[model samples]
Target: MDTNHNKSEKSFKIPGDWKEQSKQLKEKFSTLTDHDLKFEAGKEKEMLERIGNRLRKNREEVLNIIKEINLS
Candidate 1:
């Protein structure tokens, strides 16, 4: 219902999958810089926030895009 809440939900389901998620992100958003893709341990929110800002999208939208990235 809310932006922050959506971000929370998206991240909640994948707490330990950041690296895999980041890899999937690279396949989809090729333009993302190394810094943009870096998911430092314990900094997932910062990672998502940076990505959301770069794409000019809300957290939910960012989450939605990445959610479609099937891990391989």
Candidate 2:
């Protein structure tokens, strides 16, 4: 069993209130549209990919941004 692949897939986690964090992200990143930030259940990876593409960032960068925003 390839546990590493599964772990990476499920690695990212929502740190705090996603709504509030997403709002902050939108404020910081004007290019992100509603569609980019729109999160669906069990679709976290997709949402991150959208945000990463819009921001020209990688998955880790997106995760870090979300974490930093939630901390602030």
Model 1 RMSD vs true structure: 4.5
Model 1 TM-score (2 dp): 0.61
Best by TM-score: 2
**Cα lDDT tens digits for candidate 2, 1-72:** 666664645546677688888889999999999999998887899999999999999888988888789788
**Clash count list over all predictions:** 0, 0
Cα-based TM-score, every candidate: 0.61, 0.83
Residue pairs that clash (backbone atoms under 3 angstroms), model 1: none
**lDDT of all predictions, in order shown?**
0.70, 0.87
List pairs with backbone clashes in candidate 2.
none
User: All predictions: root-mean-square deviation over Cα?
Assistant: 4.5, 2.9
For residues 1-72, write the lDDT of model 1, one tens digit per residue: 555645545343453466787776777777676798786766777877888888788778877777666434
Backbone clashes, candidate 2:
0
* Model 2 bad stretches (over 4 Å): 1-7
Q: After TM-score superposition, what is the CA distance of residue 58 in candidate 2 from its true location, in Å?
A: 0.4
Give the C-alpha miss distance for residue 39 in model 2, angstroms: 0.9
Stretches > 4 Å off in candidate 1:
1-24
